[model samples]
Target: MIKALFKKEFIDTIRDKRSVVAALFGALFTPLLFAVMMTFNIEKARSVDDVYIEINNADMAPQIVELLDRESIFHAELPSTGKKFELNGETHTHSKISLTFSDDFESQLSSGLPANILINADYSDQERSSQIRRVKRVLENYEGAVLNMRLVARGISPLVIDVVDLEEQDTSTPGSKSAIILGMLGVFILFSVFVSSTNVAIDCSAGERERNSLELLLMQPVSTFDVVASKTINTGLFGLFAGTLSIALTAVVIPFIPLHKIGMAFNFDLEVAVKMWFIILPLAFFAAAFQLVTTFHAKSFKEAQTYIQYSIMLPLIVPMALEFSKYKHAALDYLPIVAQQQAISKLIRGELTDFTPVIGGMIVTMLFSYGLVLFTSKSLKSEKVVLGL
Candidate 1:
């Protein structure tokens, strides 16, 4: 009986072309956008192009000028008018940054006094801060070279200046190294559940009520529990379909992401996909039950939409909040959104030891979902609720 009702609801949901398209689009949303943005940023960071800065008293600091040139920074005449220009297919703009060597630059260096190199840029203007930083780096490099030379000339070891040496040794395995970058994928997977089920949940609950078919369906021999179960199951299937496609699309899209350039790698494979599926399986039901419960309380189809849109944001918001916070607990890993994120991230890094956490999370999420289904089923038996009052 539940299968008959589920098949009926599922067929009705499939007929909504706009809703299916939206679900498909939502599946591709994060991977496509984040990939493009990250690729552009990585290419920009790695490619070295000439940065032009105005130089004053160039003759007084020939060594500094040469050092700057070697670093691909050079002096160039600025156009009097334009603020931006295209160079080698990349857009660049004059930052109006200037380097001014003091009048007594050579004298100060020879006398072992501090040499002043004034870097002039609008400090408050955030847009040109990168130019300002690049200029400062060159000056600091020159200063370090002079300091080493002075120490060696005085029969002192150049190493004497260092009280301690600090070196970094990265212990991150290739799989674990990209956890931060790939954590976003875990988040998108969970959010896709709500995106896929919104239309179906609203249609099965609020849409039927608005069309005056909800009352007629209740007049049948079927119990309200069977009706609730059928709707929740159908809605969850949509979420599952969207989630599966999201994983498949992400798997295809991840190869193109240049995580290697940033010393990160997405260890996506069949095993990880299988683990992620286990994590999202219960999330599908959770999202469906959550959506249906909220939509069932609405007075009309439009109100259901308003409620579902706001209610669905819980998936996006909870992970963002807990992930950013410094406080973390073992209990949180057993919760819904946070659990899926943690589980998927561990699975990506190949660090998942056992199915304990993910399976526990599945149980907790399903319990909440089951509770919502029962509550909604009980409400449906009421005359006020079935009539949209």
Candidate 2:
């Protein structure tokens, strides 16, 4: 009998265009958007390799120009009027960086006097800022070499000027460095579970009430527990479908992201995908039960939607806030969304070994889900909820 009710609800939800569209949108849109954005950012980072700048007096500092060339920065000619310039027959907008060397630059350097080299660029432009910094660094290197040569020529020990040597050792792995991005990805994955079942939960509860069919269904021989359990199971099945699709799509998309270009690595292997799907499974049930409890209280479909929309903020915000917080409470590992996020994050970083937290979280999540299911079943017995009074 419960199976028949579950099949009915599932078929009705499948036939609803709004529900199907909502589910597909939740499953596909976010992963595609993340892939496109990451690809664009990585390509932009790669474009910084060949930086072209204008040199007003290239002959005055051939050595500096050679240094710039070695650093992959080359000279380009620009018109005085417009921002558009051509390189190798390709029209390109040039950066504002223009180098001007004083006529006495070589002479001043030869005499150990200050040589003026002015760098003119738009400092506020983020794309050109790195190139400008690289140019300045190369010029400083040239100046330092000349200064050391002058000191040696004067019979002064160049080592006398050195006070301290600083050495840097970075111990951060690629996975550890990409923690924040992975945390956000985990949030989106969990969010898919909550969002995918929202419309279905509303339609089964409030929409059924609004259509005047809920009371008639309640008058049947089946107990309230059976009815509520059927609806919750249907909704959770839909959430599970959406969550699975999200994980599969994410695994496919993650490899295309050039995280290695930025010194970060996130491997969404088959094992990780399976583990994530496992983590999200209990959350699917929790989401469905939670949504059902909230939606069953609303008098109509629209009211339920409005209420659920606001209520959904808790799931989205809580995990994200915990991810961004500096101080983490150890007890959070046994909570619902927080625990799942932390577990997935540790898994991505190759740091998750103990499954105690995962097991604890799953148990707590399932218990909470069943509690909501019971509350929803009890609510179904009330005349006010049944008749939408």
Candidate 3:
């Protein structure tokens, strides 16, 4: 009997063209969009390797020019009008970095006076700003070397000026370093479950009522628990399909994103996919039951859509807020969506060994889902809900 009810609900849901299209689109679009954006950013990062700057008085600082050349910064002739042009089938804009050395720079250095080297660049341009900082560091090194030579000639030890030796050692792994990007990926993965179940939940509830068939189903010999359980199961299956599809697509697309270019290593391998699936599957049930309860309360199909749209924000906003918060409480890992996000993030960073929090959250999520299904079943027996009063 339960199998027949599930089959009936499942067939009806798949036959609805709108629900099928919505499910497929929600499952596929986010991963594809993420891939395209990451690919574009990687290409832009690679383009910074060959930086071209303009030097106004090359003769004044031959040694400095040599330093710039070794640093991969070459002088280029650019238009004085500052107009955009095309190069190699791509539109190009010249960076506004100009170097000008004073004519008496050598004399000033010889006399132990300050030598003037003017760096002109648009500070507002992010790419140009990075190049400008590189240029400034190179010039400072040259100045320090010349000053040390002058100290040696004067019978003074160069170590007289040496004080503190500063060094940097970064211990972040590629996975940990990509926290921001991975956090966003987790959000999209979790959101797919909600999106996949949305149309089906609404259809089985308010949509059935609008079609004037919900009353007929309610009058059947089946218990209210059976009816609600069958609908929730159907919705959950849709959510699970969408969530799994998103993970598969993400695994396929992540490898081609050039994340290594930015020192961000994200491996959506089979193990990670399997872990993510476990983390997200219970959320699918929760999403289905929650949406079922919410939609069952709405007076009409359009009104149900409005309620579900607002409810969707809770999942997106809550997890993101927890992921980015400065003050993280350890108890957050025991919460539903928050726990799942943290687990996925740790999995991405390869730091997750203990599954206690994840399992705990899944159990809590399932219990909550069961409670919502019971509430929805009880609502089905109410006259106001059945008659849309």
278-349 in candidate 2: lDDT tens per residue? 998898888899899989999889899999996567568877677688657777778877778778778877
> Where does candidate 2 stray beyond 4 Å?
49-58, 69-99, 119-132, 148-162, 323-328
TM-score of 1: 0.86
Descending-lDDT candidate ranking:
2, 3, 1
What does candidate 1's lDDT look like per residue over 199-230, in tens digits? 88888899999988999999999999899999
How accurate locally, in lDDT, is each candidate?
Answer: 0.83, 0.86, 0.85
What TM-score, computed on C-alpha atoms, does each candidate reach?
0.86, 0.83, 0.84
Pairs that collide, model 1: none
lDDT of 3 by residue, 68-179 (tens): 8999887776656763555668655666688888889878866788989888877988867888998898898998998889989989999989898778899887777777
Query: Candidates ranked by TM-score, best first?
Result: 1, 3, 2
Indicate the TM-score of model 2.
0.83
Q: List clashing residue pairs in candidate 2.
A: none
TM-score top scorer: 1
